[model samples]
Target: MASLNRIWGLIVKELLALLKDPRARVVLIAPPLVQLLVFGYAATFDVNDVRVGVLNRDGGELSRRLVAGFSGAPAFHVTRHLDQIRQARPLLGDKKVDMVLHIGPDFGAHLHRGRAARAQVLVDGRNSNTAAIISQYAGSIVAAFNREALGNGGDAELAIRAWFNPNLVSRWFIVPGLVGVLTLVVTTLVTALSVAREREAGTFNQLLVTPLRPPEILLGKALPAIFIGLAEASVIVAFAVFWFGVPLAGDLRLLYLGLLLFMLSTVGMGLLISSLCATQQQALLGAFLYIVPAIILSGFATPIANMPETVQDLTLLDPLRYCLVVVRGVFLKDLPLELLLPQLWPMALIGLVTLSAAGALFRSRLG
Candidate 1:
């Protein structure tokens, strides 16, 4: 009984000491509220709020009438009316526009003649996930509108084909991009805490006083996790291709190219996170806190178009989202290099900035 009492006393003392730490309290208590809100609202695949540009060459009452309905639909908002197709190109490039509705000049004539009129819908294939969803929604909306207007039988013949992922396999879309996400998870936490752990264990000062240069320390700490991330990526890709039956459509070279740049970005971001945090707990909590939104906002599991208007626009800041485009495009769509350069440059730019920032921070803080 005396020994039991002594053990319980020690346990209570440790608990009390833990509770006394302000940082522990903040890490444990603060995340739940933030995470609950993030997962609750943003974790979804159902896409909405398609920003549609209407190019109406047919200024007839029919064209005018249809434009109102497209805008009025809750799913689509008519952002602008472009005079020419060239005008819409910038919006697509900027990702300000989701889809364009070009009402050809013959639209009224065909409808009047009781023939099928073609309204070409051009999608910003840059964001194929959002592009895919928008394509489906726009087609359905237009067809339903056409049926109602034509007073045809209950339906029109719809033989829609999905180019990249015909099976609509979720993993085909998700697994390739999972490479980036897994890297973020491992790299972010590991790097975020690499320096911080040493500091918390009370070894940081000793290490700082060593002969090793700051860049060497940072690289030495970061390289292990970067290697692990790369291995994990290769395993996941192998599993996806051999086990899950996801075809590696594009050349392996492009896949590696995309993955390489992406990993550089992840490692750089991890190094940056590590330099900012002062302790392991802070590093861990901060990594988890940041990665949750980073994953959601990446459009890996959820389509960006589904997010609220404000949130969708802000997703551009996440490097993972752009990386996802490259992975999915290469692995599934086999998109050409010309097609992927738009995604490639922004991420490389971000990676460079992250590396430069981390180096500066380490020098500033450690020095």
Candidate 2:
């Protein structure tokens, strides 16, 4: 009973110490909420409002109609009308225009003769993904125009459907992932600096004089960060669902289960970093070093399948990688326990190993 009381008092003390400062309270709460709003609205995959150039050598009615199609597309704005094809080359090179549609002199003749009309599209390949999306948008416009011109009463139409995110809004994908990342940034930094801050303030000896064992001390330090992490995560999740309209299709119980396990892994990793550092500056640097690579390899911004085979193999060790899959799956797909077990086991194993290692290190340091 006395040991339980001691652990409870230690936890309360750590929590009070962390929340006592006004700056610390703001730091803990504000950044994650701001990043949630900013990244959700701004970080997008849909390439809209692109500049396009038109070179109409034909200057015929059909050519004008096609030019109007490009101009009317929501994805494109026809910014320049070139008299000569040669004029577009300079704009393309300067990136003043993302694409140029060149209508041939014989384009109307080919259309009237029932021959396939041809248009050349020159795209800037600086950003290949954006260039490809531009091509698709242009192709869609041309295809719709062709269907209208032919009056295809019997032509088979293909209807494309997207699952999970039907509208393919990047917000639906990015906002949930930000929950894991923001929680990671906040929790890791808070826990990573916990030990170092105590040491720097000359409170290490004071802590040692207490009857609290090393594991109890570690728990007192680690639990508060985990609690703060969960609070930050809850705020992000609320904004994602209510403000951004990203639905939480999964069981709330399972989603919280994943969040708990994921935070355990993060807390353990942070404690390990804190145990190795002598000062708060080193702790901050250490957290950055771990976080940047973790975010990259976690397949948040890019698909892991697109990475090299060896790099894909390396991602298996990243707790963030699995946590992202869990959070996204729960948000979009309502993944079942059987489906999530593979990720959960790895996180549990990593938490146990890292926390055990950190506890031993702290004990040795105190000894």
Clashing residue pairs for model 1: none
Write the residue-wise lDDT of candidate 1 on 24-109 in tens digits: 67777888887886676778766667788889998986677667767887889999889997887667645577777888787777
What digit string (tens of lDDT, one per residue) describes model 2 on residues 1-367?
A: 9999999999999899989967567657865665564344433557776788888888887778888888988878999989887887668654578788888898777776666767888775433455557778887988877776555232212132233565557788789899988988888899899998988788876877889999999999999998999899999999999999988999878777888888888889899999988789768877876776677777677555445566678778788888887888788777788878988889888889889999998999887
lDDT of 1 at 83: 93
Best by lDDT: 2
Candidate 2, run of 10 with poorest lDDT: 152-161
